[model samples]
Target: MEHPILFISIILEKLGLPVPHGFVGNGLLEQLCAPYMTYTWLVMVFLFVVSKMTLGNLEMVPGGGQNFWEILIGGLDDFFVENMGREMADALFPMLTTFALYIAVGNLIGLIPGFMSPTSNLNTTLALTIIVWVTHHVIGFRAHGFNYYKHFIGPMWWLIPLMLPIELISNVARLLSLSIRLFGNIMAKETLLGILFMLAGAFFAPLPIMMLGVLVSLVQAMVFVLLAVVYCAQAQEHAH
Candidate 1:
């Protein structure tokens, strides 16, 4: 049988929805939408239901899924405190939490049958990169006023010409790196699992690949979050 996730994507395409075409062509908007919209909505619904249940009763202690979610959120809350500091992190926590949970859930859900992770799509990753790009600069400008442009001048007025091109290239490269790394990891894992199953024809053969998939999923989420934190830090630095 074909990869169920890929098959679902094919179905979506036939229905005239956007999905990722990879490097092949256009018409692959679902790659972006899957992670950002469909999967995100599912995560949100899950969160809402859980919130209603858990917060419905004021408890000093959490139990079951509520406990698990509380721990997870607490860890993330601590992470924001450590990295983003108090004020900035407080201000940025919503966006950070949303991005982290959305991508993490998307990655984990790909392990389920008939679901492809949207982060595996280059276009989706690129769109995310663009969001990061815009957010960093917007925050920077808001914090530092027009002097945010000075980041490119290398602390010297004479260096503007050279610094501009270098800074531009570096930022552009971040987008390319973000997109390509995610696409390569996900597509390659899917391909490797398929080939392994074909060779062994045994369930055990694919187990190793799935384990690796778990690692890849986690690492990709971390990479994304780390970059976001760095971008936010940069913006905050400029604000100072």
Candidate 2:
């Protein structure tokens, strides 16, 4: 539990706050989201309330805090709409926004001294990828009915026998790619920063690299959201 990111966990562990069997006394690795999960949940709730306050308002003009959230939502809306089209973007807005908020927050939290990004864990990223993967296909089915599999069956009927397994494998590979990409990037940044802090100096030498880690964190979050938008756009092609 002594890895640099688990500063909060060390305190909780010391207080005997109950570890789940195997997590007991693991120095290098602890549960992925035990202490951080509660913080992540609270952050989500805060964002939800902010969304309601801004979006649910009848006011034609936004106030200060409302304006901040509006800009974020509006900018992200435009980003997705540019890629996915207005109709599909509008339809998938809630899911896209939720993904952006959670992943962005999760990634950025890793920059905090005592906190770990859940996105750094393969299981968490895989769960999210699976959700988006299943969701888009479900939307595809709803939009295209049985015709949805047409995307997988290849553009030519004669190619089904040759293309089917290839298509299926590629589809499944998306799960791995999405999860591994997020986990690998975040974990690399986290581990690199820890090493820099240790080897560089006892103090200020790691600051510049840590600042770059902030940029890396935000970019990773954006890349995840952007990919999700692309997948949704591809799936809901019927609406166009």
Clash totals in order: 6, 1
Model 1 agreement with the true structure over 1-240: per-residue lDDT tens digits: 343445555666778877654333344554444433455456567667867887787567666767877888898888878887888888888887877776776676666655656666566677777887788888888888888877766657687788889987887788788768876787677667767767784657888778989999888887887788888778769421
The list of candidate 1 runs beyond 4 A from truth reads 1-58
Q: What is the TM-score of each candidate against the true structure?
A: 0.79, 0.83
lDDT of each: 0.71, 0.77
Question: Highest lDDT among the candidates is held by which one?
Answer: 2
Assess the local accuracy of residue 117 in candidate 1 as a C-alpha lDDT between 0 and 100: 65
lDDT of 1 at 130: 81
